[model samples]
Structure formats: structure tokens, C-alpha cells
Target chain A: MAEDLVLDTAIRDWVLVPLSVVMVLIGVLRYFVSKLLRSSQTPDAKVVREGQLILRARNLRAAGGFIPVKSFRARRFYYTNEENGLLHVPKGQAQNPQAQMFSDPNMAMDMMKKNLSMIIPQSLTFAWVNFFFSGFVAAKLPFPLTPRFRSMLQNGIDLSTVDVSYVSGRSWYFLNLFGLRGLFSLILGEENAMDDTQRMMQMGGGFGVDPTKNLGAEKDGIDIIQHEWTLPKMEQRAEMVLRKLVK
Target chain B: MVGATEEARLNQLESQVDNGGGGAWEYLCLVRKLKARRSEKVLRHGIFILNSHIARSKLGGEEWTLYEQVAVAAMDCHRNDIANDCIEALSKKFPGSIRVGRLKGMLLEAKGAWPDAEKIYAQLLVDNPLDQIILKRKVAIAKAQGNLAAAVEYLNNYLETFMADHDAWRELAELYISIQMYKQAAFCYEELILSQPTVPLYHLAYADVLYTMGGLENLQAAKKYYASTINLTGGKNTRALYGICLSSVAINQLTKGRNKDEKDSADLQPLAAEALLKDYKERAPEKLPLVTAMLRNIKLVS
Candidate 1:
């Protein structure tokens, strides 16, 4: 039954409104920046072929039951045959973790550019919020929260006596950081770079997953499939149905 | 032609926005929807919306997509200048964009600059070997140049890498059929049928190809596929029903005088004939007598 803090109208203008507006503007700016910085380099042929190979292999594994045994065997042999198979990654091929990033300077450079775009704007916004708004408590939330939220919703503040619902300036900035995703998506289209959540996922996706490993996995997948020529079964089924219709 | 009701709905949308009401965004959205549905003859409305300065400014982000769309429609309608303007704008905006480059290549193709278009596509392929658009354009270029064999080669090469692309398989199948390579066409259809066993379209096409092949084994396979098509479509596919009856009769003729094979399709003839007769009776009662007469001539119902 503790009393709620009556937030000043000035806090609304200087803190809350400005924080929201700046977040939006920053999102828009970041989108345009990333769009400009996006490398228009045509994808390499080997990488393209590898992706297509995976897709083809996946399709074979999923739908190979339908094709004739001869065709399926031929495909399996083409992909999984020990010596000259396409999916075969020679074990002698020593994989260096950084080798891909180093060999393809363009790819590494593109990622660097992406990271810079995301990181620079993000840090700048953090710093801007910290500098201007510092320890100023921005607003009070209407709803109650557990004491566990106190540290999260009250980032830059020292006194822990305040309710967990009271959002501090820095925490409000952090809140706006993640919370404005919907607003950003609304203002900018779904594919916009304004989505940090997607960027984080992409970052975690972590480049150069050693294409050899992917190929080997697909190779194993294709190796296990038992070919059941679907047309033969269909013929029998059709014959059975036709026979039954007469009966 | 599109249905009159669809045309009327479009007309209302077009006039309401184009004449007085200021719903440029809504009109643009409708146009985009039409584009998604692949509805042809949106050229006039699209060009009008694109040309209007009011709508132009209001269409944030979607403006470029609209430009690309209208440019394509303009190219299809043979309005080269409009396409040129749209391409110029896109190229200016996204200087080295592959999509814009494609538009440029397509523009060259539209203008009948065969070699130039081919050169652009070749360069695009070189730059991005994985670029399916460029590869597809290469096939298109070969087709446009009246080198169907080359087109087939290019498409085959494309499919060799991208084997899972059903659309590519379908296109290749059609190309094979067009060149009268029924065997190759049948192979493509077989692949299609195998990949998508549930699709009646693939079954029907495979049946057609097998029927065209016309051996005892092929005819039997064709009859089974036709039956599959009928079953998949819940017996509503008239072509499939007809195909079933036709293939069944052909199958019966082939197996005549031979001791009936244990798993023979002799009984399918009557079932398929009955279905076709029932379908014709329900769908087109006027044609039911003619169908009955035809069935009688074929000796299915006698």
C-alpha cells in the first residue's frame, strides 16, 4: 500500500517523449545506414552451389521414397559415393576456424561492416541516454512488479526503496531499446534493419559454419534413406481400387 | 479474362481513388495484392497511380516495389520509355543492386538487344554464380534467340545444381514437351510426380506423357496415373476422368487375348467410364448424350 510517485510533466517532455522519439529516429537512421552499407557483391558460385546441394539433398531425403530405386541409387551415389561424390569432404582437408574469414576478405569485411553498423549506433544511443538523462527517474509504471525487476527497471539508480515499477532514465532507454521493436516494424517494413532482435539472431547464426560439416551431415542423411519406388505401389493401389469398384 | 465482378471491384477502387477520394495507399495496397495474385491487365491503373505525385510521396518504402512492378507491367505492354524511366530511377537509387541489374537486363531483352542482354546476364552469372535469376535469364535469352536446344541445355545445367526447384523442373518439363521430346518430357513429369505425389496436376501431366509414349507398359502406367489424378481431385477433374477412360481402353486393347494378368487393369475401364458419364451428366447434362455415345463407340459401356 505504498504511495506511487507523481511523475512531473517535464519528465514526460524531456525524458519519456524524447526517449521514444530519439529511439524511433535512431531506428530509421540505422535502417538507412545499414541499407547504404549493405554490400551488393554477387554471391560466390561455390557457396551458391553448396546451398543448392543441401536443398537438393534435403528434397531427395524427404521425397526420395517416391522416385524409382535406380534413380534414387544414382542420386545417392552422386552425392555420397566415397571417392568422387559431391558431398564428400576429404578428411585431410584441415579446417581453420579463421581461415574462411581470412580467405574471403569480402565476406569478413561485409560482416565487419554489419557489426559496425549495429554496434556503433547502439553504443552511441546508450552513451547519449546515459550522458543526458543519467540518474533521472523517468516515469512510474501503472502495474506492480516483483522486487526482482527493481535492478532491471532501475539501472542507474542507487536507492532501492523505490517500487520496481518506477522506471529510471537509463532503464527506460534500455526498455525502449527492446520494446520499440513493434513500433520500428510498424514504421519501417518487416525486413528493415531496425529489428535488433533479428540482428542478434543473425549474429548468433555465426558465419562460416564450415560448409564441409553441413555437407557431411547431408551426406549421412541421404545415405540412410531406403528407396521405395512410389509409382509401383500406386499402380498396385490403382489396380486394387479398380478391382474393388467392379466387386 | 478476369471475372466481371473482379473487374468491377477494381474499377470501383480505381475510380474512387483516381477521381476524387484520397486513398492512394489503399489503392496502392490493392494494386500490390493484384500483383501478388498475378492478375494481368493492372497496367493502366498501376501507371496512373505511379504517375500521380500525391500517391508517389505517400507511398513510403513501397514506392520502389511499385516502380519495379509497374516497370514490369510497362515492359509487358511494350511501353519501353516508361520501363526505361523506372529502371533509370532504380539504378540511380541502388546503383549496383543485382535486382536493378536484372531489371536493366530485362529492359535490354525487351528492346530485342539479344547480345547485350545476354552479355549482362553472363556478367551477372560470373559475378554471382549462385544467382538463379541470372541463370534463368540465360535460359530465357536462349529461348528468345530461338535456340531451344541451348535453352534446354541452360535449363538442364541450372537444374543440375538446383535439383529441388520444382518450378524449374516444371519449366523444363514444358520446354521438353514443346520440342516434342516426349521421352525427356516424360522423365521430367516422372520427376515432378515423384516429388509431389499429391498434386493432381503433376499426375495428369505424367499420365498424358505416359499415354503419348504408347507402349503396353506405358499405357498401363498412364491409366494408373490418370486414376491417381481422378482420386486426388475427388473425381472432379474432367480431363483426368477422360484420361482414365482413354488409357483404360488403350490398356484393354494392349492386353487383349493374353491371359488376364493377376494384377491387370481390365476392370478400371468400367469404373472410369461410369465416373466420366456421371461427371458429364452432373457438370454438363447437354454433353452427357454425346459422351454416352462416345463411350459406346469406345466399347467401355457396351
Candidate 2:
């Protein structure tokens, strides 16, 4: 009788139905989020971007090995080291009294103008796309591809008992979809599973070189993959765990 | 053989130093009086005189006071080089207060030890990545060696870290031109023009590239750009070169044409040469020897 119940419900309903639902939801979410957070069109960016203009102008002056100071409309900021050179003029003034024989003033001017428009818009767009795609794509994967945050969902680890429910609900979702209850079951298999507490402590997400710091910052590094769900709270202990993890 | 008069003046200054109120200016005047004698001993003794003057300025001595004194001496006696050397020495002794690396770099470049000087510059970049002088030297070395690819790569790397460095792009364009990578050079000039729309020479460089590429085929566009360049530089020497480039473009068309009359061929070719000379005189006055010889060759052909 137990075999019949297992064969009829477990194979027919438990695995097939939920897995299809999860995959569909993942695809829908990816489509919508990608659309919402795309970069603005180029002309819209160019029209009211004075900050970018000033920044580009400064860059241009610096590139030509000339210190460019844009004193536009009475605000003066030296883009180059001004202390060493004494040539100063009123804001928006283009003359270089101290410029030597080999100095190319025209080239300097061209660089300043180019920086004003193209470079700023393109770079800002790139930054926006990078952040948007990384977060959205991570969210929509059908299987829980990211490393689970065990410490974050630990019982009595911090303030409320909310994490207990969250962790159990996530465990249930994985079991229903892929017949694997947690991260170790899905990736490594039960025999080679890391101790639960030890797995919780793994941190720092990725290992790319940071040229400035030379050493990467570890405490909040890549391993802490965040997950969020929104099912109702349950009163019973096991039900609470299920609700917490599923959401 | 010390002069009796100079000896008296030295004794008088030493007595003033003993009295505790003889300032740097007073000592400097005494040194000037000694230097007027024009003897090797007097000149050598002036260093002592100047050092004593510096000592007197310091009862409440501001460094600026000594600096001003040196400036005046440099201008008055044309001892500017000595003053600069002393300033550089003092700056090095106190490294954190000022950057004398650029001054030193320029002096090294002037001495034509560009490769060794570039090592100091490379070290400067490693120590202080944002240092402008270090970047300048890096660009200069790359340009001097005609390593446009390396220069472009270095500048691009600098730009990645220092995104606002517009000068990097300009130098990259110049490097492309230097290496005769004409298409890349034109793109660089275009990038420069985009940043500095008002500058005419950028357009001039761009047109020059098109002319040098296949000549006459792009003559109209070259003429338009050359005209624009002349308009921008207020008819500076660059204008004369623009005219010369135009003449060359026209002559190239005539020479390569299938049917060229004898008189028309001769006139067109020599006109191109004359125009080139006028262009050279305006754009590169110092290159007269090589340019004139080439002009003579063109004259013989015509």
C-alpha cells in the first residue's frame, strides 16, 4: 500500500508538476528584469550631461601632458598639477602662455571636447548593464545554482526565529524540484558532504585580482549567495521550517 | 694672491656676522662686490659669501626668503642654471615636500640619456601611479623610440586606471601618426576632435592622413579640412603647410593621369615642390636642410 502511494503520488505529482512551475517562473523573471534596467539611449544621455563634459575636458588636458583647467562660467578646477606651472587665465580661457614650442594646443582642445560626449555615456551604460545582468540572471536559475547561505539562515544565530523557517522552506523547494534537499546533496552527494557548520563559514565570493588593494577583502566575499522568498509564516515547528526555506 | 680690498670687505662682513644683525641681502651685496673683481679666487670665494648670507637670513629664516634671493641672483648675474641646480638639490634632500623628479627628468632628456631617464620615470609610476610627470616621460620615451604600439598600450592602461586622462587619447593619436598606422592615427585624431571640436590642427592631421593614404582620390575632403585648419589657427605657419599639401594632392592627380601635356606636367610638378618648401618653412623651419635638398630634386625633375 505504501509502495502504491509512493508510486502514484511521488512520481506523478511531486516531481513533475513543481519542476515545470519553477522552470517557467525562472524564465519569466529573467525576461522582465532585463528589460527594466537597460541603459538609456545615447542622445538623451548627451543632451544634459554637463558633469560628463567637465570630466572629459579634464581628462583630455591631462592626456596631452598638458594640465587642463576648465574655468567654465566662473568655476575653476585645475585638471593638471597647477602648482608647478604659473600660467593662469579667466574661466573658459583657452590661451596657454607658458606652452612651449612642441605643445599642440589644437590637440589639447580636441581631447577635451571628445571626453565631453562619447566616453561618459558609454562607460555609464556598461556599469549599469553589468550590475543588472549579474543580479537578475543569478535569481532566475531553475536549480539553486548559487552556494546556499547556511549561516544567514541558522536557528537562534541572531535576532528572530525567522531564519529557521527560511532555511527549511528552501530545503523543501530543492527536494521538490530536483530530489536534493540541500547544496551538498545537489553538488557533492551525501557521502562527501561537508559538515553543516563548516560549510556555513565559507566566504568571499570570487578570486579576481584587485590591482589597487593587491589583496582581496575576505569577510564579505563571493560565497554568501543571498536568497529571498515570500510565503506565509507557519505556526508548527516543522511547518515553520518549511515555510521559511520555501520562501 | 688675494686682493687687499676684497680682504678688507671679507673682514668687514665677518665683523657684521659677529654683531648678529647682518642679513642675507647685506651678505649678498658683499658677495657681488667681490665677484666684480673677475678673478678665479673671487668667484670661488663667492660660494662662501652666499652660504654666509643664507645663514644670516635664518634668525627667523623662511625658506622662501632664501628662494627669492637665489632667484634675484640668478636673474641679475645670469646664474640661473646654478640656482636651478641648488633648488633641485634642496628638493631631493627634502623629498616629501616637492616633486623634483620632473625637473630632473627634463634635465636628463636634455642630456640625451632618454633610455636611462625612462627607467627613473617607470619607477616613479610604480611609486606614484598618478604622477603626471611620470606619465609624460613614459609617453615621451615611447614616442622617441617610435614604439607606437607599446606607447598606445601603456597609455591605454593608464587610461583604464585614470579614466579622466584625455591627454592619453591625444598622445595615442600622435603615436599612431608617428608609427604610420594611418587608419588608427585618423581614428585617434577623430577621438581628439570629438573632445575638442574647436581645434583646427586635429582636423588638419586627419586630412593629412587621407592625402598620404592614396592622394588625389580624397582631394576634395582634404581641401575642405585643410581650409578648416587654416581658419582655426588664424593663418599661422600651419596654413602655409595646408596650402602645400593641397598643391601636392593636385600634382599627384596630374602625374598619375594617363594623358599629361609636357608643359602642364612640368608646371604641376614644380608647383607641388614650391608649395612643399613654403609648407616646410612654416611647419618645420629647423628642417630646412633636408627639405631644401628634396625641393632641389623636385626642381630638377620639373
lDDT of 2 by residue, B175-273 (tens): 777778877676566556546655666767766775666554445344445545544553343343434445454655556555343233233233334
Model 1 per-residue lDDT tens digits across residues B123-235? 87666777887889889988988899999999999987777678889989999998999988977876776567677888889889889989987776677677777667666
Deviation in angstroms for B68 in model 2?
13
Q: Which candidate should be chosen as best, given TM-score against the real structure?
A: 1
Worst 10 contiguous positions by lDDT, candidate 2 chain A:
A227-236
Q: Please, what is the TM-score per model?
A: 0.80, 0.33
> Could you tell me the C-alpha RMSD of candidate 2 in Å?
30.9
Instruction: Give lDDT tens digits, candidate 1, residues A48-80.
Output: 778878877777788786555656787789889
Candidate 1 chain B has its poorest 10 consecutive residues by lDDT at B34-43
Indicate the DockQ of the complex predicted as candidate 1. 0.33
| Clashing residue pairs, backbone N/CA/C < 3 A, model 1 | none
Q: Name the runs in model 1 displaced over 4 angstroms.
A: A1-22, A94-97, A124-138, A147-151, A154-163, A168-170, A229-247, B1-40, B50-68, B79-108, B111-113, B123-130, B194-197, B214-217, B253-267, B285-290
Worst 10 residues of 2 chain B by lDDT: B37-46
lDDT of 2 at B221: 40
